[model samples]
Target: MTPAQTTRRHVLVAIALVWALVCGGLGWATRSAIQLDSFEAREDQRRTDEVRMERALARMEAEIAPVLYPERARPYMHFRSYYIATEARYRSDSSDASRDILVASPLKDYRGPDWILLHFQVSETEGWSSPQLSSEARFALPAGGIPAPVRPREAAPENWFAALQERYTAPMLEQVLMETLIHSGEVEGLSAAGPRPDAAPDAESGVRTAAAESARRAERLLQMQREIHPASTCEPELVAMENLEAGSGQVLYNRETGACVQVYAPLMTPVWLDLTQDGEPMLALVRSASVETSKNCTLQGVLIDWPKLARELTEQVRDIFPEVRLKPLLPSEMAASATVRGRLHTIPAKLVAARSPPVETWGLSSGLIGGLAVAWGATLLALVAITYGATKYLTLAERRMQFVAAVTHELRTPLTSFQLYSDLLAEMPQESAEKRRHYAGILRAEAARLARLVENVLSYSRVEETAPNLRLAPTDPSNILEAAAAATAEPCQKAGKELVIENHCPRETRIETDSQFVVQILTNLVENACKYSADASDRRIWLSAAPGPGGSITFEVDDAGFGVAPKDRRAIFEPFRRGTSEQGRRAGGVGLGLSLSRYWAQSLGGVLQLKRSSRNGAHYSCFSLTLPSAPRQC
Candidate 1:
């Protein structure tokens, strides 16, 4: 190569290196960005899921507010009443003569949430009493200490304290309540008669002193004026306290002094009583918060079915967290369940997502992640495009250098013949006409060789400049084959080979292509066949035209030359590339012959290819030209 060409090649190499480096950096950055974006997206989705879980649990807590603090639903559970009223109503709407009556109570009917198993109450010197017994039956008991209302208040309680027998069979609720009083230490000292399961305390008659005794036990804790004492009849003229709604615990207050006395905590046990249900499950008991007495408790609160209720709560949060768990707090976990307010003893259970929350692959920032991935794809494609362009430019340059060397070698033989024949013709006698005709023939053959070489060189240059100049016209396929036989006839004769044409085209079939290109393409193929197969025993070059696939005309040039080596097949049609066989080495034409033919064929909208085939188990390469067949009428 020239020094200038070498310098140009070095510059191209440097440019390619710089481009590759820049592209590599771009690729790595794109990959990193995509990875980082995916990580951030997953993190964002995880946080969103966590927030969703918290909100769902908060909504659940608000929904089950009444269950957590039952006193909030029935404030009388905190008031000082044995059979506390859940609801109250006035006997008459008339302001003058109106007495308040309890419309609902635990002892009246099991009107609490279904989650609660049962409700029962125990009074001082009185055992357990459920709503299972009618008011008449309860009042008819032998130790009945219940005040039988006289005169105006002596009204039928037929509609009050209806039997709750349907909820619990006889003795089942009664038996559980009796056991509760014993276990809770309430009946031992708080109840004067304790639990009399068979008789039930105050069943028929006894110390109408039960109310007095209960008041005394708790009176010392809340020392106050007689007018404000619970045992004293409530007079509206005395204090200005309003009945609070069920959302807040009921309280007895002296609005005059702004004092709140006996909140809801006293009427219901603040902690679970026999909640674990290790043995005979006990009833819920209410120990007055006003009176700090151990065995000095008063009444029982409602019992709840913990396991079933917990499962239901867990079910509600399953969508947020598939493995969510809602469970009663064990003694050890109870400390954690109670928040900073120092254990108000409302709910002692916990709800939690049992497993780590998962972030879906297709999540919150999926669009961003997808965009980053597209950037990575773009970077890789750009690198591939740059690399391909650089490689193609370098390959074309190498083929040009090879073309220059091959052409120099091609010009050597013809130039030497012209020199030898010119010197002989100048010195030969004027009378030797036979010698002059022979010399003239030899000169014409050599001139023909140079013309063919120049034609190929010019054709290749024209293809490089732009598209080929084509004159399209309808021409018979057989005519093209005959032209190729004539053009390559002299070359074949000199090489001791016969140029044969076989026409297999049906009549009326023609090609719609440039006839000149077709003939020149076939001529190049036949000349290659003669040069490559010069030593073949058959000494024949076959040129044929036939009907090809897809309604096209095919022209094939087949030879028994040395088959192309496996390695050379790929580059055989590449500009300036030649086979490594001994026959190809001896052939002296620039390698642009087949390349130019393919270019021209393609310009005429046809394909030129070396069709691999074996004739009678002997390998022979066939160069085939397939062109579009013209439309013709029968």
Candidate 2:
């Protein structure tokens, strides 16, 4: 390669290397940025998941507290009577606070010396016996004034305690306790107090109305009191002992005290006895369970389905992060380095998961990398294409400049000849007619050559601007050929070259074409054949017309000349391109003949082509023109 070509190659290589380095750096930077972003996102997700699990566990614990505590208290409530209740009474006379008395049962062992045996009255008038009596004899009742006679033995402290225990069964206590635990302190009243006496009425009817209204008001007050004091019983005189209904065991919370109060809905109200004749009634018996406090109650150690909880957490987290898996851990198993753990509110458990979930890298970044690569490739291709186009444009501009110089040279030669010949003719006297005629002929010939060159230039310009204006008509193919040959006859004779016209087409053959354009094409080809073969020994030019394939007409021009080189054949048809043949080298015409002929022939709906060229001895070249045949009717 030339030094200039070598320099260009090195420059292109350097640009390619620089572009490669830039792309490589960009790719590495993009990968690093993506990795850093992914790391940050993963850490954020871990923190977010930890917070989410903590909230979920808190909610779960809140939900599970009520269920677990109630379930834990169920068995205790069921067996509360057997474990908690005894025949016990507070000592009224004891100054020492520790001297409280518990009456012992005869069926069970009693080791306490401070414990006392006290009698319970069988009838209202019969009061409790002193602790000094024996346990069996202390329960004897008075002989007379008993409204309802009872067995004296049954009133003993041990027997009364046993009866009370049997009467308030385990199942009843259990129901009361369970209700109290669940509903807290809300309860319904068993009975209301009797109405108080209103003011004296003016009439008996008025007295009756006032009494009824007073009774209704008292009933409402009792309901209100029940609601206000859900954990307490009503006053005894106001409430009719027999009218009271059994309570429905339901629990409720006391908002003021934050206490779990159980309502032992009374199974039976107090029974009154008129044992004393003083017209006063005393309570015979009242059977009811005492209210129990649930402050120390607990429901810890309740079993929680940990696997199910983990699976549920996994499902919940998967909705937010599809690739994550949540594992359940005990409080003891939460120290693993790879695992992140959070406490569950519902149970004593922890949730564990990977800090970074499994994710497919290709799904996230392959498309990004591929897109970047494609964009880089497209940009590089565009840069290379732009460089090549600019180079080609510069080369064409140089060729155009050379063509301008050649055209100027050709124009000056013809102009100089015209000037010289015209000056000689103008100065010659009228007597020397032969010399004047000779000068005039030379001037005309030179002018004709100049006109042909100018016409070719103008025609090329028109073709370049748009299409040629073809005045198409139906015409005899023979007439067009004959006219072209006749026009070239004078030029051939002046140059001392023989011209031949052979018509192989029928005389009646007609074609549709612009006659002027056809003649121009024929003239250009004939002129080219003559000028390029001027140095040949034969000095012969032949023009022929014949029928062509596809209902077309053909015209051929042949000459024995130095043929165009194979490498330059296609180039010679370009505007401003001339043959590299020896004859073409010495020729004085601009290289517009073949180019214009081909353009005009195409405009007239035909073609002009170099049929063949010979490089051997007696070199020959032939050019052919083909025009579409007109319809027979046209």
Candidate 3:
């Protein structure tokens, strides 16, 4: 190819490459922003979940303790809490999995702080659904807070048992199970596969083995109960609790079933005696069991941290029932549930936990992405100027401006298509009733405005250059006047004003001018009148066409608003010399609207002159256009 042709090809290639790079870079940037936003959103959700979980745990401790140990229970511990643990397992043939939990709470009316509860989903399926009971608690009990640690040993004397007649089995069961699970070797795989043979039991076993298993499971169950119900977060410790001494160890097997039910219900159970000394022995009894699985448990109303109670009991059972080498249930291995409520209705615990949902990050994500994108754009521009010699490279700025113009044209083309199709749809006679009522007439107005914008842009481009060809045709001046008046009427009504078309032209008169040009002239004149007359009490737009000396028409549009100054009169028709602020506010434009309209009339062999500007109610602008009469057919 020749040098000029080569140069042209090079410029085109550069432009194409730059455009592609920018587009792809922008797309990638957008995707990165979105993904980062998602990550941040997940983090926020996790934080929110943690917060809610903490609240729920706290609340449960408060409620359960009050019911189980009234003296220990405070006002906050009035409401009961059921402890739960949930574990999920995938079905063999499906991607989706189901979760099981122990000890679900049935108490639904969560009266808590607004910011913490109302908007969140509290359970596995969001609300209360498919909850597991891990361990049941009687009151809020911290790990190792119970009086007598369960261990293989001779039962406390008959007096100890006599004092513990009111003791219940549910809370003890939950604590035993929880402790066993937590100490299990296969705890890590709780969410996935079951425990290995070394860690868990094999199914087939003789009656003796089964009996042993049952006894072990029972002991473990009680351990889980203790784990579930623990002491409150803020209760003051009693010296008597620390002063109580551990008793001598001995194996006390339950002769009835050969199962060693290690009864840790000590008469001198220091944790209980310390409080009972000051007041009555507040019974922290387990009201129910809602355990679904080990890791997943829900104690309907736990007076203690059932899981922790379970753990403690597992140790206690091990110590007391030495001959039974039983394992504490790993959190994954045992499911136990129980409830604890005050004998009297309103004991409260200072610490309370609330269940709530995750937080949303849409606004944060969007703002972050937007800010980054704007920064990246600026940086990219700087890099381009520095590395690409943009200033010296083949009139880059000019080419860029041209590219913008072309791009705008491309954008406007689609908009034009939208306007046309939408307008047509709006005008469809067979449209649905709902659509007709909702969307009719909206598109046409939008299209007109868009068309006007396109005209203004093109007009500005041509301002310093020779204008485009103005094709003339013999047109009826009266028709052009009427169309302009009709167009202005819509705008006038919207502005709470009025428009009047005074057709004084003789029906016999017609002008031979470009019909488009005549329409343009009348539109401009009407617009000026409206702008200057909007605030006037007698706001009106009058259009009149009369036969002039030779076959021309004198068209006028008059308004009764704030008029223009004499010094600004001639300048208003000049390019960019718009009417002052008052006029501009009433009728906004880039100021080329009138100038272009006037130019179009002149180019079409017609005159467009402002008739008059007045301070009185008769403020108006008029234009007289002259053209040859339409040729008559023989």
Candidate 4:
């Protein structure tokens, strides 16, 4: 190899290595970027899931709060009376020594603690007597007086009062007192009052004066009650309550004065009223009706089912954050730093999500990236192929240019020889006939060489432009070989080379092919052998034909010459591709002979190929032409 060629090869190798490294580095960087993006995406998804879980937990807690603490609900129960006529009748019997009567009080329908009534004695002569204290003071009795009470036949009066005293203990009295202080107005007529207008000329003065007078009277009444019941430690305080006209129809009247009074206490148990003139305290009847408790103890009269509520909340969280898996944790197991906690009634639970978000590679879509990579690779390959094709095209073009220059030089030389020899023949007519004949022969040979060059160029151009037009006919292979050999026999003799034709084809064998094209194939191959082997020590050309496989015929042209180089053999059949050898370069023809011969053989529905060429032992080269056998005529 030449130094220039070796340097070029090394440069190409280095460039390929650099390009490969660059591609590998780019691929690795792309993979790392995708991994980083995916990690970030997972983190984002995790944060989002935590927030969603927190919201769900909060919603669940709100829903179940009331169910867990029912006392937080609003109050709905109010006081109403229930009658105890049986106890009233027993107390009214004349033989009874009990000072007070026992009756059921209002609030019987409530869920906790029973209620009762106690009627103690008070009197007009005993300073506890007043018109407000008497039940008959405001409303006159009906013609039949009051309704007769029902008596329980099995009951004993003595046992009943003793049992009542035991049940209404000190704690019960305190509870009733507290209830009176807290829910007095709420339970009875006091709650239905507002401020009243005064009848005096100065309204503000009249209100103050009336309030002072009412206080004095309440103080005097309280003192009288204390004197009458000296054994009791209960201290009753008076409170002023205004009356509003919009109140419901249950008015509490002061039996002593026979006037409406908003100042009253809740009647869960009984208190003494100074009703009779006899000095014995008359009973205030107390009865209890059913009171609603559950409605008052719950929010909006509805109880929440916490388990179902928790489940629904979990499902909602799952729907919103599909990638996160929620695991419920027990109250003890729940960490303070956990993502979120949920409660159902009093039960505590925590929401735990999966440790990682769903598996995915982030950044650009994988399919899009893959598609781009494939397209980029395909485009790169296409570019490389285009570059390689362009380089080959340029090389072939340079060779063709060289071939054209060589043909031109070859044509000029023969034309100059023809002109020179014709001038000599015309000028030396008086010379000997033999000398004139020699000049004529030189002109004819030069003309034949020029004609062969021109014919090869025209034929190659024609075959390249379009498919060759072949005149198919029946012809013997030997006849075609002999004709080509005869045409070159004289040229071989003058050039001091032997031309031999060995016909191995049967006498009856004929091929269907274009006869002129077959002869041209044989002539071109033989002529090339003669030209390339001109300087051989034993110069010889061999033309032979024989029967081939599949009822075909094979024609071969062999020469004792420097065989085609191994590297150039494949390319030798390409236009303008000549052997790179001293003998081949010194030979006198353009490089179209083999290429055109191959084209013509192909046009005849046959093939022309280098059958064998060896550099060893006289450097023999052989080219073969194979054609199909023709049908026999009847």
Candidate 4 per-residue lDDT over residues 1-634, each given as its tens digit: 8654565566567656655775666667667766766776777877776676667666656654433333222111211122112212344565433213333333233232111121221111111111112332223321112222321222222222333233343223222322322232222222212234545447658756644543333333323323332222111111011111111222223333222222222112222222222332222222111101100000011112222344555665665544433333322233332433332222334455444448565456566579658855875686577557655765675677778878988899999999999888888867479989999989988988888788778887777577776677878777787789788787687678898788997788877878887888887887778777887786777888888899989888887776777677778898887788887878756788888888777667687888564433534378888887762221
lDDT (Cα, tens digit) per residue for candidate 3, span 474-575: 566668866776767776776666666666777666666566656766776676666656777876656666666666566666666656655676877765
Q: Any runs in candidate 1 off by more than 4 Å, and if so which? A: 1-269, 272-325, 330-345, 352-373, 413-448, 466-486, 501-519, 544-556, 563-571, 602-609, 612-618, 624-634
Could you tell me the lDDT of residue 436 within candidate 2? 90
lDDT of 2 by residue, 1-634 (tens): 9655675577667667766777687778767766765665566766787676666555555554554444323221121112211223447753433223222332134222111222121111112221223445423442123343352322334443333233333223222323322222233433233335756666767856644543343334334323533444322210111112111121123333322334322221112222233333222112222222211111111112223334555566554445544343321233341233555433324445445454434334556667667777886687677667655665566557657877898899889998898888889899999999889888888888788778777877787677766577889877887789888888787667888788888767888888887897888888777787887788878888889998899898887776667688688888888887776778766787888888777766677777574332534378888888852211
lDDT of 1: 0.56
C-alpha RMSD (angstroms) for model 3: 29.4
| TM-score for predicted model 2 compared with the true structure | 0.46
Q: Considering TM-score, which of the candidate structures 1 and 2 is the better prediction for this target?
A: 1
Residue 287 Cα positional deviation in candidate 4, in Å, after optimal superposition: 40
lDDT of 3: 0.44
- Two-way lDDT contest, 1 vs 2, winner: 1
Alpha carbon lDDT of residue 32, candidate 2?
A: 74
The prediction achieving the highest lDDT against the true structure is: 1
Better of 1 and 3 by lDDT: 1
TM-score of each: 0.55, 0.46, 0.30, 0.50
